[model samples]
Target chain A: MLILHCPHCDRMVDETDLHPGGEAHLKRHGPEADAEAFENYLFMRENPKGVHFERWRHVYGCGKWFLAARNTATLEVYGTYPAQTHQPPQTIRDTITERQPGWAWGDFR
Target chain B: MSEPVSALRGRATSGSVQVSDMGLQGMISLRCDLSFGKLKALSKDLVGAPVPALREAQVRNDRAALWMSPDELLFLMPHTEVDDALSRIAKAMKDQHHLALDVSDARALLRVEGPFAREVIAKLAPVDLHPDVFGPGQVLRTRLGQIAAAFWMTDAQTFQVICFRSVAHYAFDLLEASAKAGPVGHFPRGT
Candidate 1:
């Protein structure tokens, strides 16, 4: 089973203690947005093989939602951050880029 | 009022583990922003100790507050004193954004004690139960077998596991089965 560090509790918790949320940092499209944009926001996903960002809730532990950046194929978690932010932190992106050369994630390289 | 029946009233001890239903205890599920200075002080006043840190517990006399999550805690005391405890806490936090509910009858508590207690728990829980990791006063909320449960280590050889009243029988059965199976084959190591 995968183990993730919950930023809120500062503990390395098993996957069983967590609930996986879908892709992270998705901008919400409300009534102000066009139909196509709203549909894409709801139905579309990156589904990338590597370097994905996702949301996770430490349901059984801290019960706080957090974001995780990781390589989907290797399951190597780059880092975990609080869920309140609208985007991944720059330090986490830099670390990912350093670890996986030439890797790029949405709005980050 | 009708008397409450224990979940494991007539279970016989098996192997080195002894499981006993703790009967009824006052349980209050409390939720608040612990980071707020005033609320933190109020919690301490209510529980007679500071809010526990992370998975830890703050115990004083016969009362305790187990940290269930960043924003949640479980207050436990003698069953007869639950109502008083609830009212006092409610009055203290009348102006705060908080939720407190008396959950004394909503869950059942089972106590497991013996030299093999850790092993018995290890078989059904994914947590690392090494002495260094989960010693006395540490509490955790996780699934025991297929049912969600919370438990705390009261001493070296004893643990208190709490699950919803609806699943108490299933939890007891699972624990009994694990106890009868003897030592767990593998201890979970950090992944």
Candidate 2:
């Protein structure tokens, strides 16, 4: 079992529990979001071919969002970060924080 | 020779597009303290072996499948025997600081097996389905589509997937999509 460090939690978990959220740099606009907007947010995907930065959640455990760099072809993860501060994009950090979520998590459930 | 081969294989010997009506229809929620004595003995007796206090999954063939939590287990059985099992668990667990609940209506169980079942499991859930990673008698509390599912690998080719009755449709859709992708080539890739 591979344990990955989630930026938000600053910890590791068995790959079994964490849900891969695809690419995660979309900004949440308004309350009454439209179907097109929601579709773009949900269905539409970046599907990068190289080193890609994406958002993830410690869904089953911590509920925090993370910035993870992964290789698309090899499926090797390079690094991960918390949704806390603004960091300059690195060769590995591809997904910039467009509009950071108020909190990178829901609850500590 | 054809008769002999057919007889050797019963209804489902398993191959491409094989289907088995897995007739499991009940679930029981068991909350017992691993630190407790009576409950541990009862679990061992029922399983006919020592119940690992903290392992996630254990199986004893068709008789039962056991799961371990921090201090809980959810046992599934045939619908008709739910009450009997519950009472048995209760009687065995008396004088112990544990809770046993019959959550039969909380979730539904289905067995989806074939070469393609793991491919379907890869889409929404996150568990290592490879035999080396997820061996037989392993269980995981994960999601299937949007519904929470408890997955149990009963054997190399058979798996039991469970979810609340409400989101059964989504599970079916995901399974269909996985089948379309492949029988073995459909495992989940990294995001």
Candidate 3:
């Protein structure tokens, strides 16, 4: 089971108490959200290789929306900080944690 | 709601004040926003910090507990803190928007702790409650033995479950039956 530490609460949670969020949240761009645009928005993916951002919900607890840093190839988790920033930070994409995986992108306790 | 009041959703009576027991060891519920404008400040006052608070959840404070959701928090104060539990909690949210609800009247708590405690709970509760899956400090609002319940894992294989007080006696029957397989835990945490 996945145990996630809420950055806000600092408490560990099992997968049972959480709900999986949708694919990486693509920042919604105003003025470009037409009907056809909305459909494409819902059905598209940019499967990037490096640090990618996704939406996650702490259903059982805070129930607040947050951003999660993860790598698609390794299913590694970089960090799960709050989604306060309107835009995803680009600095993380180049980070490398020196752990078992040689970088900070593996499953965390 | 199509939900049926089972052994978990205990019945409420008119003459005697309604009550709820989780049929577990430690249990307490607090409903308070207390008119506190901001959640972070109110929480910091209740607990030392404002993190990991939710319904049915438990935060370890030696003997006291803290679980705050958007508005309310259900505390499982240790068995020793009952007498003055309310005051401390009140002081925490003294200047904030707080509502201290006397859960003893509407909720019932039942504890099952022993080697086979989990075994008996499995009969009624369907969720996989193994230690690894349901870790400590986790709270769940799930159904128990046909009754909806809020389950909090206080320790390994130890649980504090509570529901509305209306069906307290019915829960007693089910808990008593489960206890046959193992001994009951302690009474409510504090008082």
State the lDDT of candidate 3 residue by residue for A1-109, as single tens digits.
5556565445555455567776555656455678767766676665566545677766655565666776666766766766676544545444434322344222321
- Cα misplacement distance, residue B85 of candidate 1 (Å): 0.9
For every prediction, compared with the true complex, DockQ reads 0.63, 0.09, 0.11
Docking class of 3: incorrect
TM-scores, all models, native as reference: 0.91, 0.56, 0.48
Which candidate leads the pack in TM-score?
A: 1
Q: Scored by CA lDDT, what does every candidate get?
A: 0.82, 0.57, 0.53
Q: What TM value does chain B of candidate 2 have?
A: 0.76
* lDDT of residue A99 for candidate 2: 23
The alpha-carbon deviation from the true structure for residue A87 of candidate 1, after best TM-score superposition, in angstroms, is 1.3
Index of the highest-lDDT prediction: 1
lDDT of 2 by residue, A1-109 (tens): 4457765334455565677776655556454899888777666666656445566666664455676765565566667777553442453333322222121221100
lDDT of 3 by residue, B150-181 (tens): 65656654665666678656655665566564
- Tell how far residue A92 is off in model 2, in angstroms: 25
lDDT accuracy of residue B144 in candidate 3: 59
Question: What is the DockQ ranking, best to worst?
Answer: 1, 3, 2
